[model samples]
Target chain A: MTDFKNLDISTAKECLLKKEFSSLELTEFFIDRIKKSNLNCFITNTFENAIEMAKESDKKISRNREIRDLEGIPIGMKDLFCTKGVRTTAGSKILENFVPFYESTVSNNLISDGAVILGKTNMDEFAMGSANTTSFFGNVINPLKSSEENTKDLVPGGSSGGSASSVAANLCMAATGSDTGGSIRQPASFCGLVGLKPTYGRCSRFGMIAFASSLDQAGPITKTVKDAALMLQSMSSYDEKDSTSSRKPIPQYLDFLNFDIRGKKIGLPTEYKVEGLNSDIVKVWDDTINLFKKNGAEIVNISLPHTSFALPTYYIIAPAEASANLARYDGVKYGFRENSDDLEDMYELTRAKGFGDEVKRRLMIGTYVLSAGYYDAYYLKALKVRQLISDDFKSAFEKCDVILTPTTPNVAFPIGEKQNDPIEMYLNDVLTVPASLAGLPAISVTAGKNSNNLPIGMQVIGRPFDEISILAAGKLIEEYRSFL
Target chain B: MSIDNKTVRKVSKLAKIRINEQEEKKLIEELNNILGWVDELKKVDTEKIEPMLSVFNESMVMRRDEVFSETSDELVLKNAPESKSGFFVVPKVVE
Candidate 1:
């Protein structure tokens, strides 16, 4: 029996190329693992389809055809991406049974690259919450239980919680995740995985269910930075279907993972060392700075003065966009519909029943902000502030090649700890949101483990479309810590 | 900038999401809590700054007006909650 858990994507590809194990055997290994695991990582398992695809991949390999980057790799996709003929829930009842006739550009790109689809992973409803607790399918339990607090169930952080958990638990080689305000990075931090949210528009958003369209960008949650690079290469493509899709050339990111950080300017934002930051995470940040320094990288103290406004700006802008994007889900074309006597009643009832509390709260906040009287006061002001926030990063990037910070304020907390308090929950995205706001590529890599043996992650923020730099920096840390 | 139950109800109506008396009470507290926190944005001096419409700072990529691929009507209606004769079935909008 192959010890698939010990292998990363690169080594697995090498094994596949050398005929150590067939794609069918590898797919069955993961399918069996998924059946045995209790992570609740997947909302839907496309086992039969995956097996069929893996069989086809074996035939192509035997025929001596050119293999694609992700060929024969069994991977989980966040439920946000619409999979043709498979349920794409976005972890909401509104799309609970919604099977798309079309595939998302990202998923289609993955499929075209010869990747075998494992299933749809669970996430926050419409990718709203910071904790995965808001998912309609139920909360994904973090496999990393605190050694000290063994009684409590640790949460695999939000929105991309399932993606992070599955990759961490070895259920699949890697999985896709959509990050809007730290969904990818925070969960990656909590679950001890590599999560990369590529520059906005680096990956097309053709059929991914819109959360906050402007902020939402799909990337990968993988066990290693190199796997993230490979998954992202397969996931990104320019499509006319999404207007925001970048026409820029996608680089062979794995080629840039040499970890030679000589003379690389790494900026440490002083504002990130705020009062409430856990001291352990601060120590990890300090240790990371030293690690980079030992690698001959210059660590300069920088200030993004507008950092305080990021969460507020994100809350206002994200919900405003979400209200607009989600307006189409009035039980008209797909998903759940509530019975009512009148059109207006049906629309209201269906939405009320379909959406959960966090989603509803955001929609209400969105509607209120975009409403006539409050438009200029709330939405417009928030957008202008967003400009300042983005400008701060632009100015900071001019001075430094990359910015480093703790991925989250603290390590993974127990599942139900912060779900009730919205503001407490929103605080999880504070460090991760600035990059999303600027449409810059940011990656979270495991830095160290905390006192309780829970994983902690450090984020590397790069310039717009400069994913290679951040990936290289991430690779340095990934190697320095020997995380892989 | 404080949100009240009345404001929550009005916004919920505008959003076309039904909030009951209990939910409205809860929403009022939650919305107020969030809005209170969001009020910090008002402190920032954003004078003369243009509202960012998008991060790309690029014009929408438009294609020439031509039919590219023919999507079957059945494919479009595949996920509909209710449909009949290649049309979505919904509560009467007009009369």
Candidate 2:
């Protein structure tokens, strides 16, 4: 029996170095698991390609060659990333056969470090939905072990649901996930793992399929916080190819893993203590606070009064940007084009056949908000509210090193539950959207399991370029909890 | 906060997506709910706040307007479903 529960990168690295197991053996372990489970976690598996890469890694290790960092390690790339010569579907039929000639900067960084590609995980089409049900392929179920027999079970929160599910189920060591709103953190919260969304511009967006360009940033989803740190350290680098990539110096994340957080001040946003917060969620938050207090950390209550408007503002600004970015796929560019009689017919028919229902809804909302007369009323108003929210964080950071809140208002709901109600689906992101709108660094760390055994996460949010502080604070929480 | 059927139809057309009457009704309900939720934002006083269009603090850096410094092979055109000789093909507009 191959057991790979919550494996860390350093453990796998030690195994490779000691010759206890080969890269091929490790790859086979995951590939076989994928074959047996048939969990809708992945959209495409490059098994033959993965094996070839593994063999090459083995040859290097045998030659006493200085193995590249992350050598022989396999990672699942989200389908939103553009992989050269591999199908780069963004969980939509529109780009089903679209093969990117160029590799995304994040993937390129992974390849340069000798990380082997395992497969492209599934997601909500264009990273649009909070739940995985909007996927063109099918819903990706939560991989949590359940005692109930007849219950359909919970959703593996999305739009990066596939990434979280695969890592939680040990289908892959670590996976890449894009967080436009709550894509990475929500899934991580639902599936019981650590997920990080770095400050905007910390990671390059060169070849990532754009959702909301201003807000979309890619980061790591993994079991251990240390592995997530290592992965983010590798993936975050200054690239001239991406204009938005930060020119700031990269810090050694692993070096700070053992640093103590004694006397570090943490804040709890008063606005987050709202009316409908699940009692279990509030209990987790309170428990997390006690743990932090016990670790010699100072806790304060800060006000981010702009929290209420964040969800509405995010919905407006994100879709408005998506409408413009997605206009490139007009049936004439590189994507699936349907048969039509005239030029107009070609565009209309192709788009009508290509996008799913949720995508269309967003596009319409986007167009309406950004249109001539409504721009001032909707788009501009949302932008103003967005600024107030960012300012709210800036003010809070002045008084505290980090802010704490619940990752989501409640636990994961069952599949086919929120499909009929789009508003409820959007509301799942309420607690998460504020951090995203401000482009702050936030992480979701598994606090504990609830009465129903579902995982709940406590979010740690920090100022821009202060990701190290957030990680340090999260480590303090994890240490207090002591290896769950 | 009420999004009428006519408004939903117009927005769908503007968005370049084809929708049936059933979808239009569904969209109206959904949009109305969204608008009702968003109306809460009006209560907040954003009187003095400047709108943040982009997160990057940098504003409008100028670039050199140099012409045709170099060009790569137009390999992107090859992936298109329909293309002519070295150019994208579309139905004749001035026939």
Q: List lDDT for all candidates, in order.
A: 0.91, 0.85
DockQ, each predicted model: 0.83, 0.62
Candidate 2 C-alpha lDDT tens digits along A251-355: 888865866777888899999986678898999899998888878889999999989899999989999999898888788868988866777677767887899
Clashing pairs in 1: none
How many Å off is the CA of A482 in candidate 2?
A: 5.4
Candidate 2 lands at a TM-score of 0.96
Clash count (model 2, backbone only): 0
Q: How well does candidate 1 score on lDDT at residue A415?
A: 80
What's the number of clashes in each of the models? 0, 0
lDDT of 2: 0.85
